[model samples]
Target: MKDTAKHQGLRNQLVKLLAEKGIYDTNVLNAMNAVPRHLFLESGFQDFAYQDTAFPIGAGQTISQPYTVAFQSQLLQVKADDKVLEIGTGSGYQTAVLCKMGAKVFTIERQNELYRKTSVLLPKLGYRPRVVSFGDGYKGLPNDAPFDSIIVTAGAPFVPQPLLAQLKIGGRLVIPVGDEKQVMTLLIRTSETHFEQHEFGDFKFVPMLEDKNR
Candidate 1:
């Protein structure tokens, strides 16, 4: 009961922070609150779980800040039962949020260590993404094509063509594109041959590297 109360307190604090920052989407807020962020971090890092900064999660990857996760998830405009694809599954925090939002997620992680750890943790968190592979996130899951929404956590120089090909018509793809310094971008697939792009704002992220499977 004490752990539950602690998690609830953290959730309330996060909701308050997000609201003050103008993240007014109720769905996003609910999803963020539902997932226990502290469980996704190292036990010692529990105190910082409610804070709005990224933290190390081994293999040079960091669990993205809470606001950033909410921002990207909101930009995707995910809907209930929507088939979603997540490019990076670091810590599985974002994946858990997406799952709690009622999306059927297929997440891929390139790092073997992160993938292994998250695979075990996700089931314990009560939300298991359909597929968590130690493969190239850049290539995406070809077998699971035509996703309603796709989210890329790492920064890429340009939107990968393969991911574009995997989106269903009218689907949205939210990603960060650039080198060390990046900008969050949203791409809407208007038709079989047309896509509309929107730039969100300047941000920084780890560079998206091609996994060995590529």
Candidate 2:
């Protein structure tokens, strides 16, 4: 659970890899570096934490690859203090990065076990998202609608309507949509009734699940 000297060195190398692969947002890069990815993994896999691959975090979820996290984060265009609605809270690693970048995050996880584990673990690690709920991410947090940005950590077969409805005009939503392989998609709420969509190629992710529990 410690952010050891070795972990920081690995993260520094990871920052370089992310940079070579085009994740140029300084905030995103710094946040990626600052968070110790090893602490998010099982002890056995801790050494591989910064190697640019997803590692299982139980409950059928994995801590996302650092590049995917950084890539999506950069696309989010997060501003300090932006109210970010995160649709998945797997391992709380991504949430930690957002928090480090000064986003007030409201994150949801469908599985209660992962929810409880991360809810406890995050605060212990110093991440305090605005809210962390165990529920259907597709529905989002309507009471906290008008978010400045939203990021979905899993692959969705289709874009959920409620999530889109929750964004403030001019807000951004970053999601991956597809079945076998997802196309990283971004939506900008350009008007009260209109949105701008863009796709950024394919990536694999665990399918976004629904329901309050398994």
Candidate 3:
């Protein structure tokens, strides 16, 4: 489906809702407004795309609730030209948001189905990440380490050490860490060997699994 004027209106409404829900980052809100979230969903679900809730995008993964996406993105504090590594590309919706905010995005997806679909869809929508590979999220992207920030869209039982290792000094890694219900956790690499940790309430996400689809 195409991004119509109606879609734009819906997005504006969504952004307004996000702001009301405490997303004060103008960059994040503007990116959220600019990216056509409805386009990332299937045709059948497109109607509900502007809703704040999540919808299944096949492969047992959901396209992340709009609020969750906005919340994580706001926490990231992305700046233009920021090198952001995104774990779990999923629908590529979050990737598009970062891209819209002028970030150089390197994203990983573990599910083959999502990897292929998002790879094609994102570029078609003009949101081309620097690297979009099918891989293990836990490992992050070592070759391109020291990113300005990183975002994990899935729920992890614990923070992946490799992700922490990959952050630049003073860089942020925003992840949802827990079992059934996750606590939104942020780790800022303060120095060569130290990180400051903080938690921002709870959320639910599909598990960040091991390895890629075989």
Candidate 4:
């Protein structure tokens, strides 16, 4: 679907709603406004794209709720040129937001269908991340270790150690940790072996698959 004036208007309203809900980060707000969320979903779901809710995007995964996306993006506090590692590419909506925030994003997706579709869709919309690999998100990207920040778009029963090991000192890792319900958790690597932890209430997300087969 083409991003028309009406779509932009809806996005603006969404941004306002996000701001009202305490997403104070202006960078995150602007990035959310810039990305055409409707284009990321199937045409039939375009009508619900701007709403702050999650909708299925096939393969049993749903594009995350807009507030969740904005909340995670705000938690990262990404700066221009910061190397950010994203744990689940999903529909590439979060990846696009990171790109818009001037981050050099390297993302991995466990679902092959989403991996292939997002790989093509993102660049076509001019939101090109550094790498969009079809692999396990739990393992993180060791070859590109020491990222400035990392964000996990799926819910995990526990925090993956490899992801923590891959962060640079002072880097942030935003993830939702739980089984049925998730508590939004953040880990900031302060030293080589130490990390500061914080939690921000609960959210629901598709379980993060372990292997690339999905």
Instruction: For each candidate in the order shown, give its overall lDDT on alpha carbons.
Output: 0.90, 0.93, 0.94, 0.94
Mark the regions of model 4 whose C-alpha exceeds 4 Å error after superposition.
none
lDDT of 3 by residue, 68-105 (tens): 99999999999999999999999999999999999999
Q: Rank the candidates by lDDT, best first.
A: 4, 3, 2, 1
Give every collision pair in model 4: none
- Which one wins by lDDT: 2 or 4? 4
Off by over 4 Å in 3: none
Best by lDDT: 4
TM-score of each: 0.96, 0.98, 0.98, 0.98
**Tens-place lDDT digits, model 4, residues 1-214:** 4899999999999999999999999999999999999999987899989999998898999999999999999999999999999998989999999999999999999999999999999999999899999899999999998899999999999999999999999999999999899999999998998999999999999998686466
Candidate 4 minimal-lDDT segment of 10 residues: 205-214
Which of candidates 1 and 2 is the stronger one according to TM-score?
Answer: 2
Clashes of 2: 0
Q: Which stretches of candidate 2 lie over 4 Å from their true place?
A: none
The TM-score between candidate 4 and the true structure equals 0.98
